[model samples]
Target: MRLNLPSVVLFALAVSLCSSPSLFGAEASADEKQADWIQLFNGKDLSGWTPKIRGHEYGENYADTFRVRDGLLVVSYDGYQPSDLMSMDKKGKKGFDKFGHLFYEDTFSHYLLRVEYRFVGEQVENGPGWAIRNNGLMLHGQDPSLMTLNQKFPVSIEVQLLGGNGKDERSTLNLCTPGTNVVLKGNLFEPHCTSSTSKTFHGDQWVTVEVEVRGSEVVRHKVGGDVVLEYSKPQLDPRDPEAKPLIVDGKILLDHGTISIQSESAPTEFRKIELLPLDDK
Candidate 1:
């Protein structure tokens, strides 16, 4: 004969067994959950970091344009005018290119980096038109000694970020190989490679950019949770004029280096700058 227990009793017994501490250890506390996150920015100060501006000394105070306001790192220019600086063009007029790069002190070889940025203020009229819609995050930055005394910018791999007009939509996460070449689809480029297409980003909105870098092979760029660009084996192409000098003595490839944020021509803001170290899984 079979013994049939009441359905309600059986259900109660099963529930009690599942909820018992013996079956599953105590639940994780709030502190345990927070351990997963690391604060890159303290939100109150700029400690554990340094800044580099164009005109000023390498480690001195940042240029007037780059500042912290309302708890956000703002690169603003309201009272400033382009006509005050020396010109880079043949016309010989002042422009924003005078201040080119603002680099961070810490460097990383392979890691996952995340940043949130937004553009502000109107575009400077009749300014350096080429750089009107500009700003970049440079990775694998080389030492300043490699550049000429008059050189204004660092030679690094730029993950070019652009806020485009509707008609000319360039991808949000594109690679602008500065002083280098990249291999894609099994072919070498002439040290100058543009993205196949651009992903359009809405203007004046905070966009999230992420990059997963691993040495000279397999670098990935993601925007808003989607993988937008990927490249492998970035090195100098001997054929290109700019790259020729870099690879002439066989010492141009970069495997690991520091990261930097560019202050090209437009006013921009970055809120979150963080990195997560990756381990070989």
Candidate 2:
């Protein structure tokens, strides 16, 4: 059969397209793939970050506790007075609880978050005992603007970061529920904190932790590129006073929220904070 001029041109164009996949949907280039990760911490400054410290206003960086130094986001206590770091007393008085959280400006969900952190120096004078070498990455957290002036922690799921004293086997990459609970082993996990199977990280060495959060469906904690803890179904705990008011329809599922890093009296430094979004809002 003889083809018309238009048909012949169409056939030739189809043949050319089939031979060149790059014109349609080729694999992403290396630079393009790297761009997928949003560098939350710019390493030079706190450009897109805010601080909320207990007993202070949302934006107040009390005593310069949270600052950028040497290209690292650092939580230092050099500016705090010794008396300002007094421990809490029996009367539930936070003379200077000073619990602070550096929250990123935006909220996220269904993403992979990675951070490189290290605990250095010493805890502030008169700092609480439990807060030594203890810092946390607060995930799915309430907005800092909503936190009370005296609230110690935000209503969020905490990826607890701990360091060893060069002796005991203090594991890192644990979980601590401030005002939320998770489902583990197909049951509602009510405990406040649970340990992960990750190895103990001692000294001032840097440790990397990657968190895979898929809304309220599931979350995973990975250390050294290996998953050590997994859970699902994060919801507000009615028993928690701080979290009760947030319950909606008798249940407030934590599918997505803000992310923050804790001060909690520990001198910590974050070198890298990055996130890879898996879906659009």
Candidate 3:
């Protein structure tokens, strides 16, 4: 049957609407475009992340080391117990020395990760001396299965989040190389811990830390809107047994890897963990 020009146009329009709804229907709002920021934590469950702790299996949590409460991700020490003091401190006791890191399930090359965290409650009994309100975000982290059974940390560059004591000047968004190194000021800096220029954030206040990463090229640490630290060329340390094998051509540039949050035997909470893709690579 022969159809009128208007009828033929109407049919084509219907097909196009079904094929591309956004173009034919109402345009996507600005809020929808910004909504591309992916929420890594679901706020109600740990669906896309896994926990790995020293002396435990790769997937095993080793006593609920990480959990979600009140829409916040909490790294707790109530799961670990000392064998020597099992019965002596039955009334009120907490013992945890294991260093655990909660890792994202997937790996990415270049992206922006933003997270908000705060130190809360008290440190677990007999926790490490340096772990008082201590935690970090391990970017370009090795896979949990690759880490040694007793390895305390993975081969990654850390955007260390340090909460300040009530009276001292401490900086957050610091760069820490557990098994990696970076270039700064046109030199190969080899410090294990590099402090950021961020101001001291004291008490149990929420602090937002944003990290910008571009494969093996550059990484920047930001607090709020200000970039506190910037570095380039993440390479593995050849001297470290756990790190040497990861080196590439005597220089291991971290182009793509996992991301993780630390469980340093301190009580900490994370409200938002999100990422934005910068490129296809």
Candidate 4:
């Protein structure tokens, strides 16, 4: 058999594409069952989501905070009125206090969520010093309707995604427990946040962050294909007065709840947010 150089190269490229999971979408080449994988975002509109932003009524988008543009789910603060702007430090530097979360209406246990996100544009004016390129996925979040109009964060486990500034090793898909606590291994892990083992992801490039959640039993964080962090037994923090109500029977186990994306003064875009249910029928 005689093979031309171009033909040989083409064959190799095709093989690489089949083996590549980062080509596009979340868990690009995962072992997901066809019927199990559900698309959360329709890539056209906010059909299945409800927005809750600070100072706005429940379901109010509060400045078109969550929008779909060109098949991407975008968290924007474009329509914020001047009165809505928070932290007016410098002229022309606009930051709004409308910390928001766009909640997926459904709740599920024992599922895997895969989201592809990238930071875009500048952070809103007067955004917290720690929220420049900060955005995240809130797992086991509280209901949007129950949240107060001024609540900063829901009682959930945050899969914190952050981008590098320029010369620092910042990691993505780290864990940030807001009003909650979790056991990292055999002992209880505290401090609100624990950095992941993944390398720093710089720039506005799209990054795939996946979470394998098996209720309060265990949860794993993965960046691309590498398993970066894993923890178990997520529970409401009794020490935090804000989360005390969620602790029932003197023991609060977060087995299931809603999922949401945060709008913490940063512009972020999610091109794909998909989930695969691991529960047996």
Candidate 5:
């Protein structure tokens, strides 16, 4: 009989996977030729991207949240109003659940993804405190087609991007796992979020973040060409209720998936989104 994993044995397996030396798979040759960068975002339109927003249909661009203006891919909240954000339902829940993601049509496995972004203007009023200047690159994500209408976030690994508040030190390119977990330094890391070593980028200055992903073997986050964080073995967290249905053959290994951008109430802009394939992957 097949057993549902939420048991102690599942926890043990996670630990065992962390200790196994085979977890560190063979590395690619240094001289491997790289392919030319493929631009995922066309500076003119959102042609190849689809919007998935909470409380809306899959293709509904709710309130025009994601748009291209001034030749930049912008996440704007200009269409939202005080009533739109504050209106409540019978359950006392907020009516306008505007969390959104703009996903590229194609999926990727082994590649180096780069994005040039910056936080701008103010966040929508009454936005969550944790989401101020907060946005993310959702990597290895579940297909938007499978997500429920009310699902707030996709099941994926988030490379969180944050802007410094002009004083306190806040690092960009941080890691956030919504329905997943990863191995860090030969141990199973189950945290919801963790910081990188990148320097704080204050104001509306542009910041470039590059993520090198090798299937499910490893993932590295870089800032200014310096690698700030490294981890491996990104798998679906069996304990996550949202991720439970995605488990197959009791296997949680994530070999590849889609990429997307977050619109978590913060106004942000992306000037470039490009990818470089590795070897033949």
Candidate 6:
């Protein structure tokens, strides 16, 4: 039997469409079954998220501190109240602490997180004491309920993402063991640890930060494609006093937990937020 050209073309198109269910609905079902790359932000609204400012209740009231503008998560100063501002250098401008927190609703463990961030607006007041403007991404963070009303922040390993003027050169991916500490090499350091070296990026340009975390075994931080910093067995403790609590209490486990973005003192923007499970294979 002979087939017409138009009929054969139509049949081939139909077969191709049928084979690739992604063009319809089967792909979505397949995604639900596997460890897939999920977008934390739907690109339209912050529907699945709850925002908290400085440990306050999570709700829409804090929405002013964090907002979505032009498809980017913008941390701006527009939402802060005058009373909440802190004075530095005798300046009347309120500091960034008035709106210090911006957390995500869901948490995860053993996943790869990728984010692109850039500084926005002019340099402003930041840092604790004189450390410079400090912003961070907290992983393995526990429930907010674990904190006291007056508690500044809970114990979590922070991927310290910083940006600042040339004074201190503090722009590196450091590890801040908030209420915890980790063993490095053979010694125990303070709850705070800096990367071997600091890596800096353009102030306004978007920079990609990627982290691969698996339980408490190892955590890796990459910047612009280079492995800028890494630590292994972060749960282990040295004899350092700072690490003693983290070790004795056994809060170092990174297994599965929530992820959060910080709103330190300066204005920042997050353009892309995504995650993939390590078990996708």
Give candidate 4 misplaced runs (Cα > 4 Å). 1-32, 87-96
- For model 5, which pairs clash? none
Cα TM-score of candidate 6: 0.72
Write candidate 5's Cα lDDT for 160-197 as tens digits. 99999899999999999999999999998999999999
Per-model CA lDDT versus the true structure:
0.67, 0.90, 0.85, 0.85, 0.90, 0.64
- The sequence of per-residue lDDT tens digits that candidate 3 reaches over residues 1-281 is 97667878999988888778567656664225668888999999999888888878888887788999999998886656575113233446554447889999999888888899999988877775677889999999888888888798999998898998899999998888998889987789898988899999999999988899999888989887798999998888887889987776765887889999998878899999998888745
Q: Candidate 1: global Cα-lDDT?
A: 0.67
Q: What TM-score goes with each of the models?
A: 0.76, 0.86, 0.83, 0.84, 0.85, 0.72
Could you give candidate 4's per-residue lDDT for residues 59-130 as a string of tens digits?
Answer: 988778899999999988777666666545357565566688999989977898999999988887667778
Q: Residue 152 lDDT in model 5? A: 88
Residue pairs in steric clash, candidate 4? 94-125, 95-125
Residue-level lDDT tens digits of model 1 in 160-275: 87776547756666778767677776776544447635467756888888888887777788876677778877675555554466554686666777677766667888888777
Q: Rank by TM-score, highest first.
A: 2, 5, 4, 3, 1, 6
lDDT, candidate 2, residue 179? 92
Order of quality (lDDT): 5, 2, 4, 3, 1, 6
Q: RMSD, each candidate, Å? A: 6.0, 5.4, 7.5, 8.2, 16.1, 7.2
Q: Candidate 1 — which residues are off by over 4 angstroms?
A: 1-40, 79-82, 85-94, 144-149, 191-193, 196-198, 236-249
In terms of lDDT, model 2 sits at: 0.90
Q: With candidate 6 superimposed using the best TM-score fit, by how many Å does residue 191's alpha carbon deviate from the native?
A: 3.6
Better TM-score candidate (1, 4): 4
